[model samples]
Target chain A: MCQLLGMNANTPTDVMFSFTGLATRADEHKDGFGIGFFEDRGVRLFVDHHSARQSPVAQLVKTYPIRSDNVIAHIRKATQGRVALENTHPFQRELWGRYWVFAHNGNLVDFHPRLHAAFRPVGDTDSERAFCWLMQELAKAHAGVPAIAELTRTLAELMPTLHRHGTFNMLLSNGQALWAHASTHLHWVVRQHPFGAVALRDEDLSVDFAHHTTPKDRVAVIATEPLTQHEAWTAFTCGELKVFVDGQPLG
Target chain B: MCQLLGMNANTPTDVMFSFTGLATRADEHKDGFGIGFFEDRGVRLFVDHHSARQSPVAQLVKTYPIRSDNVIAHIRKATQGRVALENTHPFQRELWGRYWVFAHNGNLVDFHPRLHAAFRPVGDTDSERAFCWLMQELAKAHAGVPAIAELTRTLAELMPTLHRHGTFNMLLSNGQALWAHASTHLHWVVRQHPFGAVALRDEDLSVDFAHHTTPKDRVAVIATEPLTQHEAWTAFTCGELKVFVDGQPLG
Candidate 1:
């Protein structure tokens, strides 16, 4: 399966995304990869037609402590789009004066929709098409940027339409909140105050989060699979849509 | 004046834009900087709120030879918006299923225009506001992507309106053609067959075009000033809009 990772924090947090050196996981999703960080209203999107483990772009991400309140990363296996820079994810589009980042895991069979709006896919990908459709629908549903809860409600209604086509596990963010809808495999873990040393995988690099986090700081990390073995990661059921704000999932 | 750099070529060409090294020039435009490269239909934009001389992103541009057919680079001195990442130049938007990149060199005063469409500025910069207005107008002018001549005509009408506010020297491209509009200083130079070893300032690195270009390859470079001392750069007069296609300027 393609890999997806998302993080939303109360404070702008520096993520050691590649600190554990996920070389084994990279091989499974090696068509290309991308990562996006929302630093306030500005978005820094880094994408490459190379494996995250091998891309120079990824090297910079690993070395640089890009602080952001929201982050989304994806590794693609290229089920639909061709293996090129244009097809790489997480794809980005701007709507309602805010940048949206999205990444998907599963493939859609024949999920084409009428794109009669401002948003359109630059690349030929089912995922990009799906994203454009979602943005178009959202723009239709609201005149101005809506609150997170209202957006979640709108998305919950629209997601089922796409889910019927194929496996639709995905993650989305608009810098305000992180939205994840899973048709199959997706997991999340929330880290709160009194954080301890957190490590991903077996014998991976560990961070003494307690030394860095404030009592009020909370973080929610969503991925296709549990990144850290010790953390109590919660798995999403079929056809689940959840929104994360200030590092905590909201109804 | 804030510096703007753009390149359009028959084939993908490399640009050496370490404007930070232009300290005499940098002093005037040290607020922030950005650069965008169009690779096929895909666009890669790197922006930072740091001075070009110090930004890690600019350093990457200097170190890496990213080849593209169309490129736009800008160094901002922040006239309207606060010195923040969102306010960085070389702003991007999607229109007619193609990604459009824009960068402006001059400031506009009281340039408020009704942005009654999907395009909106994520930043508070007047430059971004101008860009959003352009996108909204362009979306309105054409239901689909218009021809270069048609777009040039639409822009000619729009340029005068914005020029009424203040300076409006700008560059825009949609991977098909490069357009330059000027209310003041904007220069362009075309390099064709019998390529020469082009050098900028004394300390600047030179490129042996003979080695990298074919006899058919033609490139047009537009900048706030003539980048190379030897080339005969043509300056645009007030309220003039010109489009460059296949590395040649079109009437």
Candidate 2:
């Protein structure tokens, strides 16, 4: 199985600590690694085909300092395609003058859907296929970018149909909001105001969030697993979907 | 927030489908990605610090064909440290002539523990500190490798103590079995003889495990959230720990 981690916040925050713990599991997921972040103007993306465990670049990621407001990460265990660069995840596309980022965590069997738009998959991953399909659906739903509520409703309608094929856990963002859905497994946690200390479950490290975050800062973390062992991470019910904006859940 | 996905099976089953979808989220987590797998002979590892969203290599992971019995994957969103390769996860250390893989999802506050063994952290991340600490603990517990049960008990004791510091949810494996502990948030699902179709909540995709898995195969998926929208995923209670082998909980 692969893994995913996402963050939506009211303030620009760094995920260096949380990411350090998650990346340690890449030894067996040699397929690849990728991460995307939204900064002031656009999205910053980094990816490598080498195993995070073995890749020097991956080490740089842990030691290098990078900050952002919204972020998503994925580690691969390669079930559908080959271990190549073109097949990486967090597929991105330009839509409505905003860069949209997407990542998936399941397989689609016989998921060859007709894409009605110009958006094409650079990789052969089923994840990319689904991403393209989402773009197509969004395009067909409204002539232009619709309101968040409308977009959510459209996603709710389109998600079940996609589930008919296989596992479809995914994370999506347009730099303004983050949309997450769980077909099988996904989890999330929100941190705000009175921040506290957090420790890594995989590693014996800890951090005092209070030291870095502010009282007005609100942050939401979504992932295949809780990054910390002590926090009250919430689990999304099967078939549940949610959208986050400025670190708060959007209805 | 970062993500982790793990699979334990009764037999040597593949986790390709689940991983394919999970890898898609790497864009927001472009910090890095990593995966670990345990086979009959030894453990296999792969990882990269690239964003799965755009990394050609991550795309290959989704499309690349690989199978394993036990698997763990991670996508990173840098929080505690820099985005470097050595900091990438699913950190591996040799113990008792077997390779052990550890992946963490949380951050530890002021987790600077002293080490008295050869095990040392190559990265500045606290996750590595925990890994080294675990190794050191194991080395101190018994001169030679003890039984799995004994090791598990030691871990249980060690885990709760760590949780006192902060969130410590994590997955640890030594090739023979998987030990999972959840101090705050975590979930698990078991798929067996009666396989069914699963849809991803994050993406418009699905897969019928019945088609790919045999009746004898029993798979236990552990994650921060349920990856499929249709499957029943059980949530791990606060301070709950379990040992999984052959896709079932151990006594």
Candidate 3:
């Protein structure tokens, strides 16, 4: 299985600490890794077939304080495709004059959907195919970019078709909001005012949120597993879909 | 105006020397910069609103030596759009399961085409708009990825439409081949067997190609101006479009 991490914040924030925690876990998921950051409508995507622990691109991601409002990252274990750059995670495409980024964590058995639209996967991975299918469906559902709530509803209606094939834990963003669907394993945490110190579950390093954040800043982070210890990480139930905006999940 | 640099090589080649020369010229074009590298069907794109001279991303690009077969890079002066990430050049989109990268050197005056297809510009730049329109037209012209010759013909037929608007010097690549079009300022050179030492035109740096490349290696480089001092760079006439494959331009 692969691991996924997503962040949506009310303000631009860096993911150096969270990404370091993820890279430490890259020992098992060593096929490849990718991350996408949305700075408004512009996106910067870094993908490498090398393991995140060794890739210079990943090293830059860890050290560079790239402040973004919406970010999606994935570390791949390669269940469905060969270990290649095209099969790396955090696939991105442009739609409706906006860029959409997606990353998946699980495999689907025989989950081939018709891709009759302009959206097509450049990679052979099942994950890329799934992302292209979703983009095609989303493009068909709306003439242009609709409201985020409408998009969430459309995605909610479309999730079951893919979830039935197998595990479907995934994260998607369009620079506006992040949509997380949990078929098996997913957890999310929101950091707001009165931030406290937290330690990585796997790494010995610790960081105090109070030192890096302002009182008005809010950040929500979603991952396949809780990245840090002693935090209010909420596990998602099976077959649940959630949309996060402004660092909080919508009801 | 921006500066454009493109490379198409028979084998994977690092652009550190060429890119360093380009970055040295980024002093005047200080709005932003971007570079896209094609690694087979996969692509690695790095863009920043920050100037290439100062951006950490550019620093990594210079030192990391990410080898690629086809490369498109731009240093922007921001003629039409604001100095933001979205407005940076070398925009990318996918068509027919192949990723296409584009970067423009000159401005297009009042050029807006009807974008009625899957490809759309996330950035509000005339360069991006022209690229999106070209993608849409290419998608419409073919059912899938056609042969290189067929694509070149289609593009040749479509270039005048964009050229009539204004300056349309551009470089485009879809991993299979690179297409460079010039309206005013563009130059190209092919390097093959018995390569010799070359010095940068703007920088004090020099590199010996004989030390790095095999005799079988062939490389075609395109730039707004000649980057090297002694290379036999052929200037492109206005409205000339050339397609390069396997490191050589087609007749």
Error of 1 at B150 (Å): 1.6
Q: Estimate, for each residue in A119-173, the C-alpha lDDT of model 3 and write its tens digit.
A: 8889898888999999889888999999989999999999999999889999999
Per-candidate TM-score, first chain only?
0.96, 0.96, 0.99
Give TM-scores for every candidate, taking all chains together and pairing residue i with residue i. Answer: 0.95, 0.51, 0.99
Whole-model Cα lDDT of every candidate shown, in order: 0.85, 0.77, 0.94
Q: Give the C-alpha lDDT of model 1.
A: 0.85
For residues B181-218, could you state the per-residue lDDT of candidate 3 as single tens digits? 99999999999999999999999999999999999999
Query: Clashes in model 3: which pairs?
Result: none
lDDT of 1 at A147: 91
- Order of candidates by DockQ, top first? 3, 1, 2
TM-score of chain A of 3: 0.99
User: Every model's Cα RMSD, please?
Assistant: 2.0, 22.7, 0.8
Judged by lDDT, which candidate is best? 3
Model 2, C-alpha of A27: deviation from truth (Å): 2.5
**What is the Cα-based TM-score of model 3?**
0.99
